[model samples]
Target: MIIEELRDLIERHVRPDMSTPVEGVMIARDEVSTLEASMSGTVMALVAQGRKRLALGDRVYEYGPGQYLVSSLDLPVTGQFLDAGPDRPALGFGMLLDPAAIAELLLQGGAAAMPDGRGTPPSGIMVSEAPVQLLDAVLRLLRLFDRPRDLAMLAPLIKREILWWLIVGEQGATVRQLGLAGSNLSRIAQAVRWIREHYAKTFHVEDVADICGMSPSAFYRNFQAATAMSPIQFQKQMRLQEARLLLAASPNDVAGVGYRVGYDSPSQFSREYRRQFGTSPSQDALQLRGGELSLAAGLA
Candidate 1:
């Protein structure tokens, strides 16, 4: 029932660009089944209606109403609404997770929130059930969209409440490390950003590891654990994703697009593109030109 209400509210306020009057909050509506390619910034994506199926590396995650997904790292992501359509489109609520805010909560809560027994490194992304309290907080937050005058004064409080819930929820550890400075995930987060920035350039793992305050061996292990992809594989995904976006815009210049994204050999670019997207660059470009676009979750 709460989700039904959430769905109605989202449908009413959802925009073509998936933005809202409230900063950091977005509503997503999708009517297609096509998989989309994009970067997953640190975000909280809660499904109010329908389902979202996302793929990262070899891992596939699918969640529906009353569930939510969070990613603490900026990683290459590809996914779609498996059950969306024109009549009953998929709807979702998304918000960026501000590290400073989480850090504040961690500082306020002290030790319980900052446990020393962090076991296996958490993946950059995680999904879990939404408790009623979290959902209610979000409900109240969205309700403020209609009260623009009260928004600036009250939005931060409710958003903080939502973060509080997430900090204490099932995926708490992941969110907690997102705020900590020296945590393995935080270090890897630095590396993820660096990789994204220089995705096309040749670089050594040791150099990146050095930048993250990690040794090459430790950094490689943590990076793989968190992203489910080796550094090279992650970079390749970025390259292909950039190329796909380029192809969508300039359908006729496949070779040039490849070269622009840092591929030296046109043949290698075509081979990898087909392997990544299951189609040659020119063919995918034609479809993109013919009104086909992967709607990678509206908020992405």
Candidate 2:
């Protein structure tokens, strides 16, 4: 009953017309959306109705109403809604978590409440029930849209409160690490940032390790723990996903696209691309251009 009410309220305020360029209002709708393989940011997603599934590396995660999911670091992922229909669709709200904000909040709150010991990597993903208090806070935050002036004045305060709640709540320990400087999660986050910024360039594990302030062995172990993929595997994902986007946006030379994404040997690129995407780059691009491929199936 609560979930149904929440769905109605969300659908009322966060309609398609309210979409934003950066951060859109969250809502529930009945549509079979395509699965996207892209870099996921640190986000908090709560499901008020229906269900959703996401695949990260080899790990798969699913959650439904009253449950929430968290991604503490960026990673390539395949995500789709499993339960959305005209009668009862998947309803959810997601807030992007900013590490700088979280760090500042931790400093303001003092060191007393911060967890002790080094931060470890979570399994790249985690899910838990959304406590009533957290849900209540979320509802109140959404209501702030009606008070446009107050949104500018009090939205930051409320957003900080929500982050604080996440820092101290169950799995709060993992979220808290996002703010720490030298933790494993922080290091992996550094690597993730670098990968996102320079996805078009070719880089080695040692270089990424140096960027993260970890030795190759330690970085590889920790990165795998956090992302469930080796550093090379991660880069391959970025390259392929970006190539897909480039192909979809325009008719470009397949070999040129591969070169742009940092593949030196076009033959090697074609081989790996085919292995990952199940088609040669040219064929894939043609299929996408012809609208013969559904994103969900292509991603699968």
- Name the runs in model 1 displaced over 4 angstroms: 111-113, 116-120
lDDT of 2 by residue, 1-300 (tens): 566667776787765543422242344454565555666567887887777888888899888888888788867888877867767666777777787887888788874566742745777678888887778777777767667777767667777777888887887777878887767898888898798779878788899999888889989998998898988888889898888878876646887888888898999989988887788888888989998755431111
| Candidate 2 residue runs with Cα over 4 Å from true position | 15-30, 116-119, 265-267, 278-280, 290-300
* Deviation in Å, model 1, residue 45 alpha carbon: 0.6
Candidate 2's TM-score: 0.87
The candidate maximizing TM-score is: 1
- Per residue, candidate 1 scores C-alpha lDDT tens digits across 36-133 of 88888899999998888888888888889999999989889888888889999989999999989998888888845357424446888888999999
Go through the candidates in order and give each one's C-alpha lDDT: 0.87, 0.75
> What 10-residue stretch in candidate 1 is worst by lDDT?
111-120
Alpha carbon lDDT of residue 299, candidate 1?
Answer: 52
